[model samples]
Target: MHIAVILKQVPDLVEEVEVDSQGTDIDRDSVKWKLNEFDDHALEQAVLLKESSGAEVTAVALAADGVDQLLYAAVARGVDRAIRVTTASARTDAPAAAAALAGVLADMGVDLVLTGVQAVDDLHGQLAPILATRLGWPHVSVVSRVSLEGTEAEVTQEYSGGRMATLEVDLPAVLGVQAAPRPPRYVPISRLRQVMASAELGSAAAAAAAPALGSTVTRLAAPPQGQGAQMLEGRPEAVAEQIVALLRERGLVEA
Candidate 1:
């Protein structure tokens, strides 16, 4: 089986974030970059599937410069090969990103594409579905488990209210891996170094074919400052009355 796992390089949560002088982009110099946390689980799943079924795993990333660290990390984690699609644009819009990925997958003849439910930075959670649509493949989102048998694959999906539904999908499918499915394996430093030194890393030059399929983002702004807290005084009943009144005023409770 040939499995393709999509990965993204994102700003490390541990590093402090700063907006650029123009306020339209982040300060790249100050931020430390790493693989999107959820993508790590997706990569782990790919590796596990390869180990159990003797499948070949290919890890792909669409990123700008300075993403070698993230790609090296994926290699260390057991991905058989790595491909980087370099984009000059700093914008991380989901549709445009998905279109680029679809192009790459088209060239690679991917049989299965696995990705995280969402990336931490943008948190759009749209890539897998968008890519599936673009590629004309069956898509299953929030999938917790997947098992391949013969030409079909069984997927366990998590739905609302903690419910799960098992589905059987044919080959050439896309799945959005949910966080609750399974814990990703840890990559030891020794293996990391070995893979970093030995893995075949390749890059695809940015496509100049046409303008991005779609673009949006009229304006960007920071979140509003939080308000100061207020203390509730008096007896429990009195405080309850105040809370109810506040809730009613805010339209959270019918009065």
Candidate 2:
């Protein structure tokens, strides 16, 4: 089996984020980058499947600035090969990105493509389904478990209302994995250094040849600040009344 895992490089979750003065994009000068957290789980799942089923796992990424570190990490995590789709802009919009990826996968002839359900930085959670639609393949999102038998895969996914469902999908399918489904394996320092030194990282030509989807960003804004908490003081009955009044005032309770 030839499995392709889509990885994304994102701002380090630990770092402090500040919007650019224009408020159009993040301030890149002070930001640190790392592999997308959920993508790590997707990579781990692909590696585990390779170990168990002797499948060949290839890690692919839409190469943004400062993505070499992420490619090395994927190699250390047990991806047999790595491909980078070099692009000038790190567009966070999922559909445009997926369209570019569809072109790359078309040439690679991948049997299965796995990606994180959502990127921590953007949380779009739409890439996998969009990619599947572009490729005309079956897609399963929010997958918690995946088991392969012969040429078919059984995928267990979480749904609304805490519901769970399983489905069987054939090859040439896309699966969007959630974090809790499988914990990521640690990449030893030794292995990490080895991959950094020896892994073959190349950019596919198709990525450059593909036309831009012409996506536009009208404006960006931060969420409103949270209100200060009120302290209820006095007797138990008085405090309860005050709490109820506050809830009602905030439209959180019926009057």
Candidate 3:
């Protein structure tokens, strides 16, 4: 089966982040980018399927600061091909982004599509389902594992409250990868360099992409700094009294 893996580059939270003066979005300056963690898992799954069944795997990403780095990385990890979808802005709206992605998948006529359950930047967890909606295909979310069975797929889905169920799903479907069947295999830097030199990455613009759904941010603000705890080191009785006094001072306890 031919598979398409939707990819995205997200802010690397390991580094410090800043907001722009407008306070409506993150400041792109000085921001480090990486593949969304779950998308890495999805890529791994696609590679695994490619290795075992010789499935043709293609990866697509939206235009962004580090998209070429990401596409080359996918190639180094054994994706058969890579495509970059052009976007008007670095921060494409979620619904509009999904529409563009769905447009790509439909054009490719892929049998199945895989993507991270959610992106770190948005955490909406809606892209794959939206793709399914746009394509009128079956969709599943929070998938932990998948095994192909003679044109059908047996999938293990995880739910909150420690619940899980395995389902038999038909093809031409979308899966939101909650966890990869295995930890993503690392591609060597040398291999990435080799792929970058040899691979031909394609680009496309989604003709059907539309304006994003109505959502406006009035302001963006940093969270309040946390207050360090005050340790009351003393006798138990003294500590208890100090706690009560402190509570009283704060009006947490009656004087």
- Which numbered prediction scores highest in lDDT against the true structure? 3
Candidate 1 wrong stretches, greater than 4 Å: 88-91, 123-125, 205-219, 226-255
- Residue-level lDDT tens digits of model 1 in 1-255: 789998877788787888877776678788888777777778888887887788898888876666676778877877888888876665565676776677778778878899887776553446888879878989998887878787677888888998999999887989888763467777788887887787778877545332364544444466776866798999999999999999999999898
Query: Which candidate number maximizes TM-score?
Result: 3
Instruction: Give the per-residue lDDT of model 2 (tens digit) for 1-255.
Output: 899999886778587877888887778777888777778888888888898899898898887776777888888888888988865455646765786788888788888999988875553437889889989999998888887898888998898999998899998899998853558888889988988888779788445333355654555567776876666789999999988988999999998
- Where does candidate 2 stray beyond 4 Å? 88-92, 121-125, 207-216, 226-255
Measured with C-alpha atoms, the lDDT of residue 127 in candidate 3 is 82
TM-score of each: 0.79, 0.81, 0.85
lDDT of 1 at 244: 98
Q: Give the range where candidate 3 is weakest over 10 consecutive residues by summed lDDT.
A: 87-96
Residue clash pairs of candidate 1: none
For residues 111-159, what per-residue lDDT tens digits would candidate 3 score against the true structure?
A: 9899988886663336888888888988898998877777777888998
What's every prediction's RMSD, in angstroms? 5.9, 5.5, 6.0
Global lDDT scores for all candidate models: 0.78, 0.80, 0.85
